[model samples]
Target chain A: MHSESSPLGEFDLIQRFFKAGADAMRSNDQKMIALGIGDDCALLKPAAGEEIAITSDMLVAGRHFFMNANPELLGRKALAVNLSDLAAMGAKPIGFTLSIALPKVDAAWLEAFSKGLFAIANQYSCPLIGGDTTAGPLTISITAFGSIPSGKAIRRSGAKVGDDIWASGIVGDARLALAALRHEMNLPESDLKQIEHRMHNPTPRVELGMKIREVASAALDISDGLLGDLQHILNQSQVSAEVFLDRLPKSETLQKQSEDIQNQFAASGGDDYEICFTAPIDKRDAIDQISTALNLPLTRIGSVTKTAGVLEKLSLLNKNGVLLDETKSAALLKSFDHFVK
Target chain B: MHSESSPLGEFDLIQRFFKAGADAMRSNDQKMIALGIGDDCALLKPAAGEEIAITSDMLVAGRHFFMNANPELLGRKALAVNLSDLAAMGAKPIGFTLSIALPKVDAAWLEAFSKGLFAIANQYSCPLIGGDTTAGPLTISITAFGSIPSGKAIRRSGAKVGDDIWASGIVGDARLALAALRHEMNLPESDLKQIEHRMHNPTPRVELGMKIREVASAALDISDGLLGDLQHILNQSQVSAEVFLDRLPKSETLQKQSEDIQNQFAASGGDDYEICFTAPIDKRDAIDQISTALNLPLTRIGSVTKTAGVLEKLSLLNKNGVLLDETKSAALLKSFDHFVK
Candidate 1:
């Protein structure tokens, strides 16, 4: 994999691999990118009345992904995860910057990685702008930029009491795939094949997020498990939540698993990339319209409640509508934490 | 140092270290950062007619710094390097995001690191908006955002054949410090103290860059050696350069070194973070006025030349005003390349 006579130097590597990838991935809707990768800094001209939304995510080999993970999938997943953050804020995709550290410059690996990065970037109209390429342990950090109308961004602190908590698409399939990958569970090859896409290439709900901007009271994407991420809303909004397990959405592949597996994974599974949100109960019809218009499921699984203290932030209920004991609920599933891991 | 018990977890770590750092570093002039720290995405609302300039830089532990280096200086230098990129474009300080990968969490180290980061951030009025933290090899990647007038950014492709080449402040001091650290040379304690700050903490020359925008036809920050980085301007502008060896600026400490050492390090040393620019002969008076107003020295070092082909892209001249022979000139200095190193 190491070539002593490689013609590409550091700058040449960026211009050839990254600059060319960005040029090919340029989308017509992304007029905000006034300049791309060739200068000291890229210029972005946001529209007159719009505000820019920015978010960054970093994925390190052996920590965020398997050391033997495919370069193409890793590239796509890195950008996809950051896009999910923008989607949760109801921002329109504009562009993104990628900082990657590679152990070595393997031409074939870079070719596949750039192909995957541009594929998803073009699909979402998020053009590649500027970034840094360095030599180190394999790590990918992407900062995605988007635009939204001023004061219209969905924030975590906007959830009000009695608001309906909603989640987009299904959760837990990605967690299930991870379980299979870890050899913690034995699954049929067909089931693994069915759910692998959720783990490798989960879609960012950009359009759905934009459509529900005026309807959703508060929002955030599920990355560190549904419960843990939702706690961000509870903490910020100073509210409590009671989630009904019977109402939690799941894929048919996930439903085939045992009840214990379904409940646990669906509740605390990370990497869902699905937007968990809340809205006033009266806006249910408007929310349904967005669901039909975008052709994406928007499932209501709980209600926001006024909180007097932090101890009552979350309540978990079983399928029969009975609140589960705190100890049993807490023992069901474990969320991933970087420090702890 | 690794500790058995860490006081902060994932979310609390961000809240205590990063978010609090940003809050303390907030400046009044940086109103463009409408939202910061706690959110799915940070919101930035650029003025109606302004454009955003973005750049990112990454530093690996062993490659960019000593393994036992100070964390505080590392934090400051990480953001300083990105600010230097914006300075090259004559853009105003706005905000930045930091993505860090660490093997373990050390509370005292984090506290000092954040203090250093905020000290420089507040000094430049650049607030911290959003970023990601993950567990991996120690690495810092910072992406800085700045605002510029529409169509007014200094670009490398704008240099003309007769443009005067200029550089701000002194050069070679950082490389001298590096040499001392590598045990390649020994210097007095006073000399080391004078140059150590240049190597570890470089000022971005933000105000000077902004002041000389209209006068400078082309500009860039000297990070990868003066000659190599000037090659970027030459290649982009399709012009050659003739730099006088005697005209290169050096501090009193640097001048105390041997002539060979002085020439080699000043010409090819990296991490200068000083602005190198080209301006028309007619703008000389204006440039001098800017130097006086900003209290920063701007020295003339060379002139751009019309080049017929890439082979003669740069020419080095001695104090006698005669072009040096190619072999002798080429053997004098070497620039750092990560892949090669």
Candidate 2:
């Protein structure tokens, strides 16, 4: 993990970590990139009818990630995070440019890192097109491109009141991993492995995202805490939501944690890289079909309401089968409070 | 120009130096760029009938430019340098992404720097698409994108041995500016002003490059000095050139410098940002027309020869009709050599 002491110079680092990773992933049926990775520029031919989607993000040392994180995982996460942006917009991944600044080059670190990057890029069919490398503190900035049909992009502002709120896959595991990294709590090695995987290797739901475009009214990826991220949709769509605490999809590892910690992690912890989208209630059956076809879980956690406030609380019933006010129960999970900071 | 002491915080620095500049540029009509500079990612529509051209370059502090050079000029130069790469391949400027690592944010510096960036971007019609900002040592990396009609790009490998060599505008001013900055030579204020402008703001020959695509066999912009950069084209094309020192275009300011200094400046100083290209003899007349229409001076310095060496001097008869071995002419410039240790 101490890559700074490795023997690879910058040029070798580039040859090892960057050059091969991009070279092995050419899109099928798409006109292969004319020039990629090692040249002054990359050349790409557009498909006959589609448009390109481009996005960029910067990760700085000691700012974006922990200083001692595995370089291989870091490279993969960088590409994965950017890909999530494209997924959120319903675009198909195409190619990307990387701008890396390093204090010094380490050969072993670069080889592993580039291998990791290439592994994911190859899986997703995104080619490494062009980029720049320079000497400085560790910083990686990537601009990823994708393609989509014209006028079909799903934006954050499309959700409407009464739309059913849905999220794909599990949540809160990444946050738990971060806590584990900090050594705040002891957990079994098996659970630790799962949490670490969730933290370092997020799988952007690209297929589900593309399919959701046909059924969801609005969409965005959850990079920040779920509450804060969903708030973006609420603010943009002018709606509020009341998520049912009982309906949230939690990982088995998360369920094994204390209930209060799991609740806080679900509401406040970020980096899930999962799609949080909304659709009309009538499309629930269609969503179920999509979920089944993708073999991925999709949960209807709540409904968007015309009201302005977001509420989360446990439900209770008296012996007479009458619903009871659970004002204090809201404080138990602290769902709304988790995202305040 | 020590921007580290300026009052601006990081966020304001980004808004002033980056955002303001982006706001002034015109959008590319050929592609669908849904979200450009303001968002986390730029949403672009792939050009339906074109191929994308991408290039990137990094300018680092204490390596690329003077430590105290104006930050505004530095910002603009970052983008301009990358644009020069696109120009080398005859690509139409589209958009660019910037990854800037700064030691500290300085408001006034950012304002001037961003204004410089916007000025060039507006002139070239390339918009600021997307990028990232980080806190680190001063470094700027720009990844620029452009497009060309499919299979229409000009490349360095296309030059033939019998082609004529041509360069646009004048050279040597940028190198002279560097000398002046170092206080190695004393010149009049007017002369200093002219040379400094060349150093601070380089004009990438975009229009000239696009025009040359029709007539030139191969092309590249002059950044790493005319001799070294032209060698790239020669090496790639596997041709040798015999450039006539007398026919080289020089600025009045350069002509006023001491002969020894002028030779060194012209031979080794980089950052000219002029287009150096090769064309078959048959296209000379048509290229002259293009030069005239564009109001740009095209100097025919020499021709590509069957020989494999870069001969800076050619034996030729002087103005008095006396033959001289130009190889021994003290007027011939010697290349500058700088070693990094």
Candidate 3:
């Protein structure tokens, strides 16, 4: 992006704020970046028998985040969501390209954004390679690249009948923070402080994803809530699933909420970057070993089944084994649409 | 993108307007794509001993083009500009990802846009592998991938002293049409129609770029005018160049203008997707032969030189070899910055 008052070109702005951080990330990690930054096009040389996994996401201000949301967290959230896609595919970190359109050039905002971006990029060994900056309403579009061994990528279409469903870490806390921020619900300041990070800065389940490729039959990062996003797996794999309402994992803060609120948010809350996956019933022990080894809470919350005569492919049952009614199910199925009413 | 009145979801919108085109493209071309749309991440497996070239460009409405510009032409131009980057690197287009943000979903607009997008994608055999669409100010950010033999990509940093400078096809017609469109200049409707495609749908010299890689010492796509974009090659190669005003190529429409207007635009027209390249003196015959074989014009316009005694790395000289004055040169050097007035 550019500002008339600022005496810097687009390349100068990138070099001053972002390029240094990218170079710093390179020093600490060796990746498949044959060329980074400052080229007509960056080059990547994948190792033998490796396929590059690519995914892109676009985040617009006021739609994806508050206009006044902290620039640092906004930057981190942008890349984190993309990394989660790579994680869902069971790919190893390689590099990423970011395209940002700013209303104007703000030096302080740029500095903080770069800091957040590089912090996660370094942690995951993904370096910034090539991008474009322009003048427009604030929007961040990132396309991340990762390497996966041939035939090793996990897909949402891989779920099979008689598979155990799993969820990585906790869900619902992010939506809880969002509710308080939107003034739709009230929460103590301390409670908001404890849960806000879940919404603002999500940790990609990349390591867990790569490790489970051998065990998990199907996987997807839960972005648009469990009940809504799991429908994607069901639709693609041509299977049905039943999730036990009482088995969904929750953080300590979310557990304090009312039973209705906990179940509602956990099952249908958007912005939950946790992974929901399915594995063969026989691999439950191996999946548990991976969960213990990584110290991540991988809870068995459901089971995949044949869709024969099932009313709903993704059925959310209550604590007493009663199916959620059509009206409530339809409401929760709305998910997160940018343009739908 | 979506409409409150439209029943389709995001995936449905993409599937209806884009997925079919992508599938059609895949049927005609066999590229490195291991996965196409409907997945968390697309997979590209670069063949052994080859590297991938990646570039991204963002075009914002009212900045890159007129708000009323044809949606079809706009779509074609978006992908064309990105492919030009790959062409500049002497890479062959493999695939691309498109991220679009639309204010609202208009079926007619989307149909025409997809028509233009798939036209070029299929022509170049660069299938649409993955992307994201959302609701926001209309913005299209594209990241293209291309394949190049390892260690063979052309770079702006490769020009050496005494290299011959060349420009592909004509250079100023795009800006000539832009001047008419902006009402900064007057032109007959016939002339406007003739030159409008130069501005709206400039072709990428992918074939010529791939052919001349063996001869070109340095290469870059001229997007922000030849005089302005050439400075990048000079700067990166730490060299100087001289361009003869009489040698600059102009379309018949641009040639019919006043000498001052012709020279001014030919040297400094923006949105020109032509390539400006440098090659060793002996490689002139090789380049000329490739030009003849491809039936494309490759005009020799200048020469690269050492910067030890040259005040300007990129000097524009008149017919008698007189250097242009600083005042005029500075005026032509603005080079289309998005945020600057």
Candidate 4:
């Protein structure tokens, strides 16, 4: 039934691109997955006491990523971005579905893409449960599932006043990568590689998020730049934040860029795939312990204030130990909204 | 951002063609749906004690359906087809994700499509949780999730010899509809309307499937015609069957068509969306009671047999008390592989 002249149809594309990445037989512990992939519908056993976390995201060609970008990285990033949401909620990754529309079924591209997706799924212990394939412009939409205990599931609206704000990993590197991809700036090959890696292969921080769920009051994944993402938490938590620009974890490569570029990257860059969370000051010691044990960077960049505005300039101090144009810094953050819309 | 001169951009197209259909606010039952549509990633809470059934299917223009067809029905059918997989497993509908790709965002098409999707979703009580939208050839991919009790999933491999074979509703209507749509046949307005309805709004039979889960030893939904779908059950169950051609349901319109056209339609016609199941003879009484209660047609077309060969004909005595060619009469049911390729 397979034919080269046929141009690799949807069924073959599914077998080559999607079926390989799915790990439906990891552990026999899941009696609910009676029938997994390679079937019309998967059979799952809904165990008592666990709530399912479902999330989906679509990555479009050009709009979401460059068409010339590596297919494997694109696939990995597609799944990774969705996994970040599960991480924010402190849920354990279980399985996910991929719906892909492609211009044509290229075997080499499919091989690499599936490898990238499976790499992350294997690392996170999630299986490729079920999905659909079709023909169109290259687009990948992934719907991921996770399991969490009832009532313990974290929400974005749980932050309280007087809470300490924390962010995982450095931000802005991804934005710098995007700039580099657009050829707006030229940098050393090593630096370019670093920035590209940051943009393409973001770690979802699943472990750190799961650990923090017990103590963190509220959490959300950073996707649409730190400023915008943090604003969501603040809005949901009904509190204000004082973010320290000086405390912002900027990559060395970003710092080496022009000062204006660095500021823009720091303020408005998206695709960080990090976790921004809030917890009461009382849990500071536990937070530190978690950071130390996981050996992952956790930076305390600000505090949740009782006021109703998200102010970042208040935390930036000039080299002379005097506050610089705080209003200017705030303006930079506010300008990100334009790019997002 | 809404520009007709430049054509609808990908983002605007997404907002119109995809996001407008999202009815995320209707259901609060799934606590795990922390973040519904309109976000980078949707947050969900998996309920305790139920495992998730995840599946995805993609439909492409000029491949799955005609582009000139009603967008609303296309949108609804895209989702309904996926939901049918869940029903086959006795899973309860929960939520779904829609990833749509279009050449351009036409506001009118989007409105109609969204109305179609939300209308069906409301009837089935499934919420549009999250998905991605992009620019490309017209294609829709839906990843749907449902919950089923652990270890209670019905599968295709559970049928035993001597089991009674049953089919729900009428078959060949969809194929007949397709033929009419393609102008293969001419019929009265009433028949044309019925055929078009069958073609456009193929119901998934979720309720009947759920009800049959208790008594059905094995089951499958007929998407790829009756014979091909039933073959799957036989292949999985490692059993064969004798089918009575006289018992096969046929609409008056189908009967009016030439015998060859009727046979081909019955054999290779796709989009039946009916349930074909096998059960022990002891459960026949209970099955009839359930069928009567549901006010649905339940045809006892045949019985499972230890013999292992395809029987297109059954030697039942006719009114003249002579043997007839049941195989020739039943030749309309063929494997889906013949037509899809």
Q: How does model 1 score on DockQ? A: 0.58
Docking class of 1: medium
Give every candidate's TM-score on chain A: 0.95, 0.85, 0.96, 0.89
Q: What C-alpha lDDT do the candidate models reach, one value each?
A: 0.87, 0.73, 0.88, 0.73
Q: Best by TM-score, which number?
A: 3
Best by DockQ: 3
Determine which window of 10 residues in candidate 4 chain A has minimal summed lDDT: A332-341
Model 2 whole-model lDDT (C-alpha atoms): 0.73
Candidate 1's error at A8, in angstroms? 2.4
Candidate 2: where are CA atoms >4 Å away?
Answer: A1-17, A24-32, A37-40, A183-190, A245-248, A256-260, A308-341, B1-31, B37-40, B46-48, B65-68, B102-110, B182-190, B245-248, B256-264, B306-341
Clashes of each: 0, 5, 0, 25
> In lDDT terms, which candidate is top?
3
The parts of candidate 1 lying over 4 Å away from their true place are A1-6, A308-312, A332-335, B1-7, B309-312, B331-335
**RMSD versus native structure for model 4:** 4.8
Recovered native contacts, candidate 3: 0.75
lDDT of 4 by residue, A1-341 (tens): 22322456555566665675564345635444556676667755544565666677777787678888898898789889989988988887877778777676677888888888888888887777777776666778787877676656677888887888898888899988877778877777889887788898999988987899799998888876776677767666767767766677788889997776776677558788898888999998999999999888888877787743443222444345455475665555542321132
Per-residue accuracy of model 1 over B206-254 as CA lDDT, tens digit each? 9987888888999999997888788788878988899998888999999
Candidate 3 residues B1-341, lDDT tens each?
Answer: 12332577676788889898888887765559998888889999889999999999999999898888898998899999999999999999999999999988788899999999888998788989999999999999999999999999999899988999999999899999989988998899999999899999989889988998899999999897788788888878989888898899889899899998888788877788999999999998998899899888899999998767664367778889999898776655556676675
lDDT of 3 at A108: 92
Question: Model 2: per-residue lDDT, tens digit, A1-341?
Answer: 01222344444456666776665564444454776764446787766666667777777777668888798899889999889988987888888888777666566777777877877788788878777776666778888887777666777778887888898898889989888877988888888997788898999788987898788888888776665577667766767666665566789899998867776687657889888899999999999999999999999877787753543222323334344356423332222211122
lDDT of 3 by residue, A170-203 (tens): 9999999999999989989999999999999999
The count of backbone overlaps in candidate 4 is 25
